[model samples]
Structures are given as C-alpha cells and as structure tokens.
Target: MPWWSWILIWVALVALSLLLYVFLGIRLFRQFMATLKDLGAAGKKMGHISPLEQAQTRPEAGRPLPGSAVFASPTVMRHDYEASKSSRREQRRLKRVQRKTDRGQPQALGDLDFT
Candidate 1:
C-alpha cells in the first residue's frame, strides 16, 4: 500500500472512533438527565409525606418502612410490635371462645373472660 493510503486509513479510523465516542457520550448525557428528572419528581412527591404516614402506608402494603424506623427509638418500635402481637392473640382467643360456645363445646377456663 502507498504511504498516503496508510495515512488515509489512519485518518478514517480516528474519525470513526471520535464519532463512536460522541454518540456514546450523547446517550450517556441523555440518560443522566432523565435520571435526574425522575429523582427530582420522586423527591417532590416524598417530601410532603410525614414519617408517620410513611410508616402507616408501608405496613399496610406489607413493605417495611425503614425510614420511619430510623426516626423512632428501638424501644418504641419493640413496644409497638409487642402491643400488636398481644392484641392479635387476645382477638384470636376471643374468636376461639365464641366458636366453642356456639358449637356447644366447653370452653377452657383460661379463655373465659369474667371481667
């Protein structure tokens, strides 16, 4: 090959590489801008919601509200957990007693709430 042909080949290769980089950079810039817009929208949506509301909403949907937990004391969280657990247990016990009574079965003395 002639030396000038080699120079032409080198110039073509450089030009193609530059074009490729420009294309990739534009794509990357567009993606970054899109991400930033989404993040801003999300921040705006979440900014108005109080931590307590986040806690209530997350638990109902079966998702953990880690954000609320961060603001609350561990003791408070444990107390809430225990309180809900005990109330559920009491409710189940009451239902069982009611079912037994309806079926004419003798209920356990422990389950009988005289109070």
Candidate 2:
C-alpha cells in the first residue's frame, strides 16, 4: 500500500531470489563433481587395457590386425618415400598455380597483354 512497504517487498523478493540461485548453484556444482568422479572411474577402468593388449586384440572376427607387417624391405620404403615426395611437389605446384590465378596472373603466352 505505502512506498516503504513496496520497497520492503522488493528487497525480500530479491533476497529470496539470490538465496534460491545460491542453493541451485551449489546443487549443480555437487552434481558436476559427482559426474567428474564417475568419468575418472570410467577412465581408470579403460586404462587397464594396455597398448600391447590393444595391438594383440583382433578388431574384426575374421580380419588380421592392421599394421602388422612382418618384413619391411628397403625398396618398399624407398618407393613410398618417392611417392610421398612427388605428391608433396605436386601439391606445392598446385598451390603456386592457385596463388598466381588468385592474383590475376597469366599462366601462358596467349594470356599475356601487349597493350
């Protein structure tokens, strides 16, 4: 009814809202901590399987494990190296061509201007 009474009611509402926010925040924080603990426990359980165990385990029912090459010859490595080097060189050439095109540069004599 009065101005002082309205101010008092507003203050009470603000205080109650703040208290509710604090309570909800604390509860959410506790839940988040519990979730983190559960995640840590799950991680620990997962960590029990070592890298060797994973490598030994068959991923498929019938297929062999991947990257289990028994013999890697020098010729095979040299071929792979040459292939990768050629691919990189091709990529660099393509990037250079793209940059020239982006800058409106001509690639051939027909594209040159004599004016």
Candidate 3:
C-alpha cells in the first residue's frame, strides 16, 4: 500500500530471478564440460582399434572387424559376402544330408555333389 513497499517488492523479485539464472547457468556449464570429457575418453579408446590394424587380424566367431564396412574396399566386401553365403549354403547341405540319412530316405543328387 505504501510507495516504498512497491520498489522493495520489485527489487526482491529481480534479485531472486538473477540468482536462479546464475545457478542454472553454472549447472549447465558443468554438465557441458562433463560431456566433453566423456567424449574425449571414448574417442581415445576407439582410436586404439584402427581400421588397418583390425583388418590385418581376425576376430572371434567370424565376426567382421569394426569400421571395416566404412574403410574397406568394395572387392574385399564382396569377397566377404560371397564367403559367408557359401559357408551358409554348405552348412545347409550338410544338415539336409544328415537328416535324410537319419530318416533312411534317399539323398538328392545335388546333395551328393559335395563341391
């Protein structure tokens, strides 16, 4: 109701708003720095697995090396694709032959060609 009270109320409101913004800004800055630190660490770990080094060595379970698709030649990719396809076909043929033998059924002529 008094004139001075109106000025005091506005001053308190402005000070509280400024404090909230400063706290929020500080929190945001800390989070951003943490994110950058994590990103750098991950980059260093992944850098240890260079494309060339992985390509020269084989991984377990016929697993392709990481980033091979992005860095490998087209011919290399095609060879890998064909090899995987042929291996699958060979496995299927073997399973079919075994199943037929177990059942006392005749085998197909294609199954006999073990090429």
> Residue 114 in candidate 1 has what lDDT?
94
* C-alpha-based local distance difference test score of model 2: 0.79
Give the number of the best model, judged by TM-score: 1
Candidate lDDT scores, in order, read 0.89, 0.79, 0.92
True-vs-predicted CA distance for residue 93, candidate 1, Å: 1.1
Per-residue lDDT of candidate 2, residues 1-115 (tens digit): 8899999999999999999999999999999999999999999999998899987776886333466333667787677668879888868777777777999887655333356
Off by over 4 Å in 2: 56-62, 67-115
Error of 3 at 6 (Å): 1.2
Candidate 2's error at 11, in angstroms? 0.4
Estimate, for each residue in 49-85, the C-alpha lDDT of model 1 and write its tens digit.
8877665663556434667777989998898789889
For candidate 2, the clash count comes to: 0
Q: List CA RMSD, all candidates.
A: 7.6, 13.0, 6.2
Q: lDDT per residue, candidate 3, 6-64, as tens digits?
A: 99999999999999999999999999999999999999989889878867776887787
Error of 2 at 18 (Å): 0.6
Clashes of 1: 0
